[model samples]
Target: MLRSLVRALSGEVDPEIEARVRAVSQGVNELGFDKWGFSPDAVKHAMGLYAWLYREYFRVEAFGVEHVPPGRALLIGNHSSQLAYDGIMVATALLLEADPPRAVKAMIEKFFQHQPFVNVMMARSGQLTGLPQNALRLLQEDQLVMVFPEGARGGGKTVWERYELKRFGHGFMRLALEARAPIVPFGFIGGEEACPSLVDVKPLARLLGMPYLPITPTILPLPLPAKCSVYFGRPLVFDGRGDEEDAVIEGYVEEVRSSIGALIERGLSERRGIFFG
Candidate 1:
C-alpha cells in the first residue's frame, strides 16, 4: 500500500528506476521480506539488465559457458578487478548458454548487503549470504553456485597481481563436501587489466564504506575492450569427507587453484592484442 502510494505520487518515474524498484519489490516478496534472500526470476531479470548495460558500455566476448553442468556445482574462479564485471560476465555467459537456463547464484561479500538498494539487486540476482548455511542450502537445491574463493582481496588485487591465485578460503571445499557438489574451476582474463587500480585508497574506501574504488582506463573507464574469456576446467568432485580434516579439503583447494591458474595463463598468452592497444 505504501509502496503503491509512493509510486502513484511519483507520477511515472524513470523506466530504469521503475525496473529497479520492481526488481527490489520482487526480491522482497521472494525473500519473505526477511533478513536476506533470493529469487530465480528476479535474478534472471537483473542479469538481463547487467548484460544489456555491459554490452552497451563495452565489447564483451565470453566462451566455455557450455562447460557449466546442468545440475548443482560450485564455480570457483579467479577474482580480478576491483569491480565485479568479471562475475557479471561469467553469470551472463552462463545464462546465455546453460540448457533449461539454470539460475546461477553467487556468494557475494557481506558488505554489499549493507546497502538497501544494492542488497535488493544482489538478493534478486540469487546472490545469497556468503554464509555456510545459505551456501549449503543453495547447493542442496541443485543450483549453480558461483564463488570467488580468494574473496575480496583477490577480486580487487592490482593488475600486475592478476592471475596470481591467492590463498583460497576452504569454505567452498567444505560446502562442496557437505552438499556433494562438483567444483568447477574457471578463470577470467582482462578483468584485472581492464580497470586496474594502482594504489590503495583506504581512507576514501572507508569513507564510502566501499571495499575499494576502482581506477580504470576507459571513458567512464569501462572494462577494457580487450577480449574477455571465461574458461572452465573439468569439474572436481568432492568425496564425503569430514570437515575437520584439513588435508582432504586442502588437496581439493590446491587443485581448484591450479586449474584456475592454468586457464588464466592460457587465456592471457592467447590474447591477440595488448590491453591498451
Candidate 2:
C-alpha cells in the first residue's frame, strides 16, 4: 500500500527515460558490496521514482551542471525541508541529466546510523556519516563528496526564514584542503515548498530527538509540490594544509556561503511563478 502511494505520487517514467535509467544502472551494479555499501539496484529503484518527481512534480531545473568537475570534488550547499528534497533533487539531476553521469557520496549526520530502516537505506545509497575520516577517504579515492555545511539549522527553518543561509561549519573547508579537492557551492531556489514549515516547534523536536521539529503548514505529511531550481557555481580551489586555524578556515567557509547565497538570490530573482520555474 505504501509503495502504491509512492508510485501514485511519482507517476510514470517515459520510455526514453526508462531506457536511460536502465543503461546507467548497469554501471553501478557492484556498488552495494563496495566500501560505501551502495546498492546499485536500490539506487536504480530510487532514481526511477525520483525521476518522476524531478521531471514532473517539482519540475526541477538544474543549471551549471558542467561546473561540477569530474572526481574528487567537495559538493557544498544549502539544506532545506524536513526530509531533504532539495538534496535529493540535486542528486537526481546529476544522475539523470549531467553529461557522463557522476556518482555523489553525501555525508549524513551520525545519529542517522542508529535508525534501522533509514540507516540501511542510507548506506546502500552511498551515504556515509559526516565524519572527517570518511570524507577524507572518499576524496582520496577520487569520488565526488557532498557536505551540508548548514547542518540541521537550514533544514529546520520556518517559512519566514526561507532561503536564508545559516551559519556553516568549517570542517568541510579543512577536509577539502587536506584532500586537495575543489569545492562546488550550489543553491536551490524553491525547496521550501517541499515542506512549507510555518511553526518552529523546538520543544517537540527535542522530545523527538531531532535537530529541528518543524510544523509544516502547506502540505502536512505529504510534501506540497512546487517548482525547484538548482544552480551550481564554478569550482573554488583552495591551497592550504588541512590543519589551519579555525579563524582562517572560517574565512574560506564564508566565501562559499556567500557564493551560494548569491546563487540563490539569482534563482529567486529569475523565478517566473511558484508552480513554474
Across 70-183, the per-residue lDDT of candidate 2 in tens digits comes to 878999988866676887788888888877787788888776888899899888778888899999998998888889998988878888998889999889999999989999
Worst 10 residues of 2 by lDDT: 23-32
Once fitted onto the true fold, the runs of candidate 1 whose alpha carbons sit more than 4 angstroms away are: 1-48, 53-58, 203-210, 213-222, 274-277
Q: Write the per-residue lDDT of candidate 1 for residues 13-70, one digit (tens) a residue.
A: 4454334434333225543443345554455445445555444333455556666777
True lDDT of residue 7, candidate 2: 73
Task: Tell me the spans in candidate 2 whose CA falls farther than 4 Å from its real position.
Answer: 1-32, 218-221
After the best TM-score superposition of candidate 1, give how far the Cα of residue 236 lies from its true spot, in angstroms: 0.9
lDDT of all the models against the reference? 0.70, 0.81
